[model samples]
Target chain A: MKGIRSVLYMHWRSVGSWVYIPWLILGSVFLINYGWRSFHQDSQSTNDVGNMVIFIYLFTVAWIFNGQLFAFASGLSIKRMHFVLGSVMAAILISIGSSLLLMLLIVVENMTNGWGIDWHTFSWKVTQTFAYWEQFAIYLLVFLCLILLGFFLSSIVIRFRKRGLLVFGVLLYVFFLVISNTSVNGFDHEEAFWTWIGQHGLLVFYSLIPAIILLLFGCYMLFMRRAIIRS
Target chain B: MHVKLSKVRKAYGKNVVLNDINMVLEKEKIYGLVGRNGAGKTTLLKIIAAQLFPSEGTVQVNEENPFENEAILSQLCFVKESQTYPDHFTVKDILLTAKATFPLWDETFCQALVARYNVPVKLRMRKLSRGMRSVVGVIIGLASRAPLTIFDEPYLGMDAVARQYFYDQLLADYADHPRTIILSTHLIDEVSELLEHVIVVKEGRILMQEDVETLRAGAVTVTGEKGKVAAFIQQQHVLSSQTLGNVTNVMIFGTISRQERLQAEAEGLSFSAVSLQKVMVHLTDQEKGSA
Candidate 1:
């Protein structure tokens, strides 16, 4: 427990400020959108893409932290399990904090009618039907999934270096290509997928719990087996 | 803590880093792991610290496998020559994290060392100079006071005075709080006096491991007439031999009794104690020659 705590504290001190970067970016983008909409006045469309910035930032943070802090912690004689536990705990804490803040912003956006510009940054029309707790759960789960995915990818790179990344990239390209071909051949599943997610709501995110666990497990195996700090 | 490596081997594909290395490191002694570049010094240290796994064989720290064992890892602190920190981390952040990680961390000692080194606590690590970064590593190794502390060329960019200060502080701290210390460095002569035992590595094998006093006492360079030097070196393990005109100098790897020395002196032969550095060089050079 103490070892895990140490790693958590190290993570906090090392890149804690990075958590706010997405907020700063989102704030800037919101200001721009609000100013544009205020001038237009006739534009009633809501901007739902603004919240994606935090997800992207969290993914990047996880990847960089896994690459950099893992080596540093290993140098400090930290156990691999301790590092995994500590990092996962830190990710959870960050998810909780960010989710609560986003929930607050959603409430404020609703009350002020998107700050008088009719813009929807934190509140999406699809999720507005769900309860506050369910919406928070959705955000938290999405954050964890992205963060864990980042950790898994970085672990692959750490274990197998550039070759692993190249292989993964090729596989991802193939996957997307197959999906695109399927859609072009009239086997369109995008609408069905979204409908399913919309029907399931929180359950859709809850199903990702297994994947989160698998990603964490993969990271542990890669790190424990052969993760050396390359010079 | 006692560290034992038996038949330890590390290889990356066909390139073997450490081969068949077997050693027992006892408690409260400083062992110098001296070797040339790519001689497997760092590989052996990493295996011992559990940062790396041996390709074959086993390593036991305090009679337990250290891999993923937090209890054992907590007792070990390995400060690498190329030790890295997060770019945004301040020196104070590093120290605080070290304190939290090591169970026997000494805050007062750490603070004093920081003051002595004059490292800026608030400055991010990437902003610090190379020498200052090395100083931070030195301070962490000294103040952590782990039961098994290993420093692999921990003073890469440090100045002469700072390096000397590190040696003094290490010795002083070791005297008060005894523990096992393994120092792997290229600067053998500078740290020879500080080392209690020396492990000479060559070509992925242990060339020799001996007590410093034993090596100093047993290895000697005898200078005398060519005929007498030849006779003296006969049936002895001669590490190296050189001849200039009628005088011959031969370094042998065996002790000379006082009677033998007196007899040799009366016969007009002079003996000089071989420095640890010289012994290391000769030993490695002999291995190269044999290879």
Candidate 2:
């Protein structure tokens, strides 16, 4: 607990350089998408602009594997447990911050009615179908789960270095082979998998939150406890 | 404030680096950790600082294991040569971060050091010149004021002038605030006078650990006529011997008292002290030749 406070404070500072890029890009996309299409007045043609969540999700993927912070904090004599705790706190904060930004974008979109061009970036299913509060909760959950996945991945990479990712890929490929090779009554496995996801996409993704949290937290603690300081 | 290591052995898979190293670092004394390029000096220092885990042995800092113990870790500061700050961090950012990490953080001292070193506070750490980057590390190590501060070649790219400034600052600061400081560096003679105790590590094994005075007393170079030098070193552990026609010089690891030196001087056997750096070289070379 003595070091935890310092670690928690370091979280925002650690990601300060990285937190703005995604939103800036999303904002540019919003402005440009409207500005370019405004002249054309293509309200009839659908604008397939990428979701802001794409950028938000990608931010964690890059931010999670920052080995420099580990070495930096270690040199400063931060305990491994404290570093991991701080990493979790950083992930939570980033996820919450990202959710808030998304909420702001949604509010702006609703106020401006898709920026007056019928653009739909943050106006996805969660914005239209769910209540405002539920929308924020869903956004928060999606962010937390995605960032948790990133954290778990970064932990694996740290524990094993470059070979860890290679090992993971191989194991995943082997698992896919095993799954695809398994067939019943001449039915295909890949087809069955996509059919399951198609029927229960929301249920499967929502249920995975607890599993991801449990696995990520447990594995990150175990691996990072013994993590070495790599140059 | 005392650190101890018992039968410490470190290896990566089968490539053993340190083996059977037993050492005791007493409190409030400046120690010089001297070794060759790959002689496990940095590894041993990291283990003591708990930035690294020892493969097989125990490292006790302040009579307690430093690993995962924030109370002990907070008491120590490890300034690595390759210590990295966040790429976006400016000098101020690094100083503030260091301040938060070290409980004994002295803002005034840090500010003074910043101005003394002439490091630009607005420039990002990654963009600074190599020497300036090292200056940042030096500033942090000095101002952190941890009870047990370990510097593993923290002045990697510093020039001679900056390095002298560091030595001067370090000596001045250590005099004002006594603490256990271990400086692991290749520049042995540059810091020979500042070191109270010297630990010479050769090929992962401690070649010797002695007080600086004792080390200076242990090895002496006897130069005189070839016959007299050879005769005097016949029963001594000769570290090196060279003959030049009618004259010979030999370095032996045995103390000659004042009377002995006076008698030897009567025979034209002039004596010169073997520096810690020269002793380290001869010791490491002997090991290499023997192996």
TM-score of each: 0.94, 0.92
DockQ score, prediction 2: 0.65
Each predicted complex: what DockQ? 0.80, 0.65
Q: Mind giving the per-residue lDDT tens digits that candidate 1 earns over B1-291?
A: 899999999999999998999999998999999988888898889899988889999999999999988889999999987888887788889899999999999999999999998889999989998889999999999999999999999998899999999999999999999999999988888998899999988889998899988998998999999999898778778888899999999888887789988999999999998887887777777453352
Q: Which CAPRI level is candidate 2? A: medium
lDDT score, candidate 1, position B101: 91
**Candidate 1, residue A208: lDDT:** 65
Runs with alpha carbons beyond 4 Å of true place in candidate 2: A43-49, A53-65, A176-203, B286-291
User: DockQ winner among the candidates?
Assistant: 1
Candidate 1 chain B: 10-residue stretch with minimal lDDT: B282-291
Q: What is the TM-score of chain B in candidate 2?
A: 0.96
Model 1 CA lDDT for position B117: 88
For model 2, what is the error of residue B47's alpha carbon versus the real structure, in angstroms, after optimal superposition?
1.5
Worst 10 residues of 2 chain A by lDDT: A45-54
Candidate 2: the clashing residue pairs are none
